[model samples]
Target: MTRDKNKKKPPAVQQEKLNPRELNTEENKHSNHPLLDTASAEIKKYLHDLIEEFKDVLLIQVRQDIKKLIKEMTSPAQENTDGRTEEIRKEREASEEEFKHNLEYMKQIQREYQETQNSIEYWQNALTETKDNLLKLEERFRAYERERKSLLKITRNQKEAILKLEDDKKIHNLRIKNVSEEAGTSKNEIQKIFTEILKQNFPRIAKRNDIQIKEAYRTPATYNQNRSTPRHIIIEIPEIHQKNRILKAARERMQVTYNGKSIKITADLSTQTLKSRREWGEIFQVLKEKNMQPKFIYPSKLSLKINEEIRYFQDKEELWEFVATNPTLQRALKDITEKERKRYQDYSYSGREASVNGADHGMRE
Candidate 1:
């Protein structure tokens, strides 16, 4: 291979002008292009350097473009991250404000609950006190009721005893009505007049001593010259039988004269006994009309003859009970029974009201 070192190459052929990239081909090397085979060493070295410099310049340009593209892509992501951070800060502030508001509302609710509890406790205590007071009042009312009933029983018994005493005092007394009252008339003169009148009517030869007059006087009243009515003469006898005899004799005679005037003689009775007797008037008249032979048995009792037997009634209530057993009597006395029932109810109601008022007065005392 060294033997042809100085040998002459083929003649250079005239070709189209080409760049180094076109000249550096496998076809040119295989074809033994005259410029490639016989080119000067300096020329080859210059072409190699030019190609290496071009590659270097291209690599630098590529690196600059890639860096610019990456910067462009990452700038928008960074801006988005900053915007998201600002939104997170605003959301945190809003959540904190809502929490504060809820806390304030919860505190207010707690305060209201405490106030309600206090009110409930106060009402409970008041209710307890009210219940205690009511119980006390009930007990006091019951005690007053018992005391009132006991007082009513005692009062009724005392009144009955007083009435009995009054009636007993008048047992031997008589009243003569329509007797002329003369001024300056003495008790002895009145007694003598009564004796004369009794003797003239009875014809028993009763002397002044036989009459047994204990005392005699006109009813106490102021004497007036212009007064037309005369006061009655009240006489007290020593014995009850003597008084009864005079009453019987007076009843037997239709008219008794004293100083040419007819007078009425009746038994002197207590005011209470007289009132009770008057209350029996209507019943007495009805019984007499029916031929029941009813007679007053002193102090408001009645003796009735029925079925040939004698029956006694102590009060209208007892008579009502007996009449209820007899349909005919009940029918006949229906209106009277109703009237009496209404009267009794009114009396009972008034009595209760009086008792209550008296009890209240006693309590105050």
Candidate 2:
């Protein structure tokens, strides 16, 4: 193209793009200043392009970092929410299990309480029944006590009447003891043997043969060869006066004999009367030793000259009471009274027995 002088002419380097590195070469250093301007412009353009590229790269990196930071922050919050939900679910499950266990425990307590109530009711019913039975037993026992007392009174009265009838059958009898028994002896021969005894012992009596014998016989007993003593004979006198006379004569002699053998003559009384007479022997001896002039009145009555008066005692209690009034008798019989008191307490015999003995003691030969 033709150069246009009227306008400003462009540089030759400026007509083409230039490398900034080419301007620094030795060849270009010698070239025109316009080339430097072109190089500077190219350098500026390259710097601007580099700056834009770096900015784009930095912006992309910053965007990626922001997304990563936002992901980091948001992911942790979601995880925390998930973990909290799981923990809440587990807590709720544990609470439900605990509640179930508590409910079962409360049910067991209710069952035990019901059983306790049932047991208490059973014991209360049993106690009420036992109390009722005890009341019934007490009532029955009182009734039995009254009946027993009534029966005791009736038994005591019946016993007294029986003893009195037994003594009346033995009133007018005389017995001989230790008479030698001869074999083949008859009742008539027994009578003759007694007649001879009266004749031999009572020869001084006026008309001793006039003492009539109602009957005479050996007492009923089985004969034994080993017997040490002979059996006794009974002499029943028809007249009471004659019996008394024979007794008086026999007592004065103090010794009666038959066929050169000693024998005894005594009133034949009931066993009860004999026992009663034997009991009076101790008191009789005591009174006789004291010079009281004691004597037997009848079956068992003791007649003692106490203070110049005769006193009758029905029992040991009566005698003990009588002795209490007299100092000399009490002192003399203190040991005997103590022994009798001990025996009385031990035997515990009712006064009815002594009264019965007293009622029956009036019979005598």
Residue 206 lDDT, candidate 2, scale 0-100 = 38
Candidate 2 overall Cα lDDT vs. reference?
Answer: 0.69
lDDT of 1 by residue, 222-300 (tens): 5677878888788999888888888887888878777678889988878877787787777787787778888877555
After superposing candidate 1 on the true structure, give the runs of residues whose Cα lies further than 4 Å from its correct spot: 1-157, 205-209, 224-228, 307-309, 314-318, 321-328, 331-341, 348-365
The reply for model 2, stretches above 4 Å from the true place, is 1-167, 183-185, 335-341, 348-365
What is candidate 2's lDDT per residue for 135-188, written digit by digit as tens?
Answer: 987765454444433443455344323434554444456888988887224678
Shift of residue 48 alpha carbon in model 1, Å: 88
Error of 2 at 42 (Å): 99
Question: At residue 46, what lDDT does model 2 achieve?
Answer: 64
Error of 2 at 28 (Å): 99
Q: If scored against the real structure, what TM-score would every candidate get?
A: 0.50, 0.49
Best by lDDT: 1
Q: Count the clashes in each prediction.
A: 0, 0
